[model samples]
Target: MGVGEFSYRISISTLIVVFPLLFVFRLAQGQLHVVGSLQPVVAGPGDDVILPCQVEPAFNVAGLTVEWSKPDLRPDPNDRLSRVDYVHLYRDAHEVPDMKLPSYIGRTALFTDSLREGNISLRITNVTQEDEGRYRCFIPKLKSQTRFSIVRLIVDPSLTETVTTKAQLDPENFHVPDLNEEIDNKGGSSERCRLIPVVVLCVFILLCFAVGGCLITESQKAELKKRPI
Candidate 1:
């Protein structure tokens, strides 16, 4: 074959091999799944906790809509509106307050920093016993086989009780003077007081010695005067 013809065949073969690889890579990348913890997440009442959920193969989901809901939660039958309420709703780079459940209105949030890393975990602040249940994390626009994950939350009241008991029993909570330390402080003050009299006595003794020396010197001068011619 001519050099030009051989080069043309080589290019065709390279494209054939490279195109399949590119297609397979794209397919695999699109198959990202939403994953959640298999174990139940435990927390104490009045504590802040995060229900872990993330997308596998890590795709940036910052612009996408995320829905967090309780699957078993039933709609309010008394309300005429047939809309489904969610625990938390995020869309268009902001949260939708109107779509959130009334109880979770101010207590639920998503980590803005982790959104770019495909972490869609929901944070619940001041968790209560009423907040214990299964949570669903979903990405509606995700092109994946599994676009949702379930996370179970458990609020243990005993944990909070234990914490309160510990706080009540903690010695640092109250100031109590040590008996030995108080005794030592009083002894130190008495010792200092006892040294004052000794100091005054030493001063008085020194003054007496000075006066006696002056008197002796005067007597010696008189004797010298009497002996002179």
Candidate 2:
């Protein structure tokens, strides 16, 4: 082959190998997307709460690393600490006890069965007021890149409404009886006004009848007084 033809063939072979590697590298660098609740989660004291987080475009998370930590966990300024505690940790489909914080060791658990479905939700049982804070759910380098979701936690005290008995509710406290009497008086006045019109109509009819009877009697008496011719 000629020198130019040889160089061209070498370049084609090099491109064929290099292009796929570059494509794979680019695919590996793709970012990981995570999803979580937009609203803050409310948990009553001494209750269990689930902090929901999931991977978008679901992929097998069984072999991946899942880390749950409190972003707003502030230690005392006097305490010496190089790193904050992790609430829960899973590496290669198993819990890493050494990585778990002392306080969260027994109270927190991950739902492992749903890992294939891409659910990385953490359940915290026996929640306390100190558990109220923003938590970070993260997966580091499972496929492409590190992904994170934020969860806001709110702790609320249990509430109960007091029910009042009938004895406690006094009827005298309300002016309902006086108001009802006033309404009845107004109704009676309206009825009396309606009866006035009816009474006037009846009196006019009686007067017309009396006048016709008197006229008939006078005509009959006059006819009787007139003798037959």
Question: Which tens-of-lDDT digit does each residue in 103-211 have in candidate 1?
Answer: 9989988988989998888888888899998777878888654567667788888775222111121222222122222211211112233244456555555655665
Alpha-carbon TM-score of each model against the true structure: 0.58, 0.53
- What local lDDT score does residue 68 receive in model 2, on the 0 to 100 scale? 88
Question: What's the lDDT for residue 197 in model 1?
Answer: 40
Q: What lDDT does model 1 reach?
A: 0.68
Total clashing pairs in model 1: 0
- Cα-based lDDT for every prediction: 0.68, 0.63
Q: For model 2, which pairs clash? A: none
lDDT of 2: 0.63
Worst 10 residues of 2 by lDDT: 160-169
